[model samples]
Target: MTEAVHLATARVGDLAAVMRVMDAAFDPLFGEAWSGAQLLTLFALPSARVCLAWHGEEPCGFSAARIAGPESELLLLAVDPAWRGRGIGRLLLDDWQAWASAHGADDYFLEMRADNDAAHLYSRAGFVEVGRRAAYYRGNDGQMRDAITMRQRPSPKSGD
Candidate 1:
């Protein structure tokens, strides 16, 4: 967080950088990280969008999402552990929300494991609990965890 981190809209060519961030951010113990092939397929979709957070040429964080009609879903949000608590994740989320808003999306939706500490981050950003699925996640430790769904709706802008 020493240097200013900026966000950029990612294209298919930037998949490598995206994966690099994802691999570093997501712990190997969880075994939940996405593969390059899967990311490529997602990037090929019409509504797919990714916002990358960079710190002096290094990919520190990123958010992957899609916009469909009036609602948008945040498929993934990850920040390197070293960059955590430095506001990089929040910046990436802000960029994602702006991107979705520009695409005619008013309702923002996201789901995450109940045990994830990042829930506080989303909650501070105006997200409210909408639903939950029991035992929705199976960790590598063989424990079943619940999933929490959250929603955020930004008030409409004047003339928007």
Candidate 2:
């Protein structure tokens, strides 16, 4: 990323900005974008957390996740298409993992379409495929796609 970017806890008041990034980042063909009302509801959940990435005053990306007990699940991650390929997605993932860890998470989990390129990002971050559900998501194109579930556990320290 050429420009400096930063992340902050996102509030319900930041819905418009978050939605802007989501609408631009997610392909409508995949039907992966959540509605504004759905997002609002998510903010009301006590276990859910959201982080918004900003480039100056503009929202460039966002990540949403939920933690329960020792596990955390990534619900969404998006970076504005115009600002992609600049490590924004990776930053979001790192921030989410950090937040989860600080909040008592021992394992991080996420599920995405089997064909989603984001898998490479997750893989590089130490997430391994744990399970899959065939024909889990139906796209707007009427084709069904498998959902791949991945998990990342804390790496071993220098000493046992």
Candidate 3:
């Protein structure tokens, strides 16, 4: 049996580890790679928030979001290949929602590849499909795919 993973808000020092998880999670689906410098820029962004999942001090998963105006957008969420299906992703999502609500956000949103398997996770997390964009991503295999937009409204009292 596998042990439960631990989740926590990432500190500044965890940037590299978070970037590794992001790169691993997005590379296959997006094909557009994020360089270390770009990751650094993301980490440094004032509106960005990141949460990490750890299994004995090693980062096994992570989630990132940015708050702008009245909404928060989930930028990324990735779990280690070996740790997939263990609920770490859900934990990160839950954490992100709670944190965003606390920070005065009333709505949460995200965009994912229409064909990405992880769409189920967002759906289960209470995000409803609101729209889609055709030919949204050009995969490494030279194929175009649609992008799905999902959104969730926070509990009225929770955002106060």
User: Residue 117 CA error for candidate 3 (Å)?
Assistant: 0.7
Q: Which ten residues in a row have the lowest lDDT in candidate 2?
A: 151-160
Q: Please provide, for model 3 over 80-134, each residue's C-alpha lDDT reduced to its tens digit, 9 standing for 90 to 100.
A: 7778888888888988888887887879999988988888998888899999999
The lDDT per prediction is: 0.87, 0.92, 0.82
Better of 2 and 3 by TM-score: 2
Clash pairs detected, candidate 2: none
lDDT comparison, 2 vs 3, better candidate: 2
- Candidate 2 C-alpha error for residue 51, in Å: 0.7
In Å, residue 128's CA in model 2 sits off its true spot by 1.0
Candidate with the larger lDDT of 1 and 2: 2
- What TM-score number comes out for model 3? 0.87
Q: Candidate 3, residue 58: CA error in Å? A: 1.4
lDDT of 2 by residue, 70-127 (tens): 8999999998988888999999998998898898987899999999988988999889
**lDDT at 115 for candidate 2?**
98
Error of 2 at 83 (Å): 1.1
